[model samples]
Target: MTTYLPKDVTDGLHAARKQDMARKSRLRVEADGRSFAVLRRWQGGFAVDASVVPPLRGLVDLFEGSSPIASCLIIAAEAEDGEMHYEFKRATAMRHSAPLDFQKDDDAPVALIGQ
Candidate 1:
């Protein structure tokens, strides 16, 4: 199922972007020992600082069923209002042969992390 960003979340992400537009960068997302997604946002000090600060309750609660993941790259990040907007696409590491169910029209998902 395709999930949408909540209204509150959209606003927060926009605000975060405005607050630190320069810091956002691409991020590689991994879960259960597999690379599951990619997010070309949240790069520099902005992401770092946020990590150090208290986690947002709403942020933590958002995205039910979303795989818990560790990220590299900080990919993309935006903040608007009192929330954060994070956008990430899945990544296929080189180690895997081909992903099932995902059809390819001569285009393959790029591998973002070490296999």
Candidate 2:
């Protein structure tokens, strides 16, 4: 026979699971100047709370805290469990330039030792 959990117990479990997801998620999406916390992410897609973000499509920026992670072209994939899922059509990682030190010049020419 199958057993069912009490309503309160099931609700508590759901709340706990949602909290865990939020805690583990560090990525956020920025679209149209609005930011929304990512609920879950994978190699090809991500999910966010439907209540927090409006219908979004096209290019969006993903960030880990203040650092940019990638630029993605996302298309609405589905909505379920209060979350909106998006599939990435394309994703490009943000590139950073190497730090330069003006005090040292390794390319400078040196005189011959014994000419």
TM-score of 2: 0.74
Using all chains and alpha carbons, the TM-scores for the candidates as numbered come to: 0.19, 0.74
Worst 10 residues of 1 by lDDT: 56-65
- Which stretch of 10 consecutive residues in model 2 shows the poorest summed lDDT? 96-105
Residue lDDT tens for model 2, 1-115 = 7699999998788677766787788899999999888989999999987876899999999999899999999999999877889999999999777656666668876775776
Across 28-84, the per-residue lDDT of candidate 1 in tens digits comes to: 233334422222234331222343233322111111124333332223456544434
The C-alpha stretches of model 2 lying farther than 4 A from their native spots are 98-115
Best lDDT goes to which candidate?
A: 2
In candidate 1, stretches whose alpha carbon ends up further than 4 angstroms from where it belongs are 1-74, 91-115
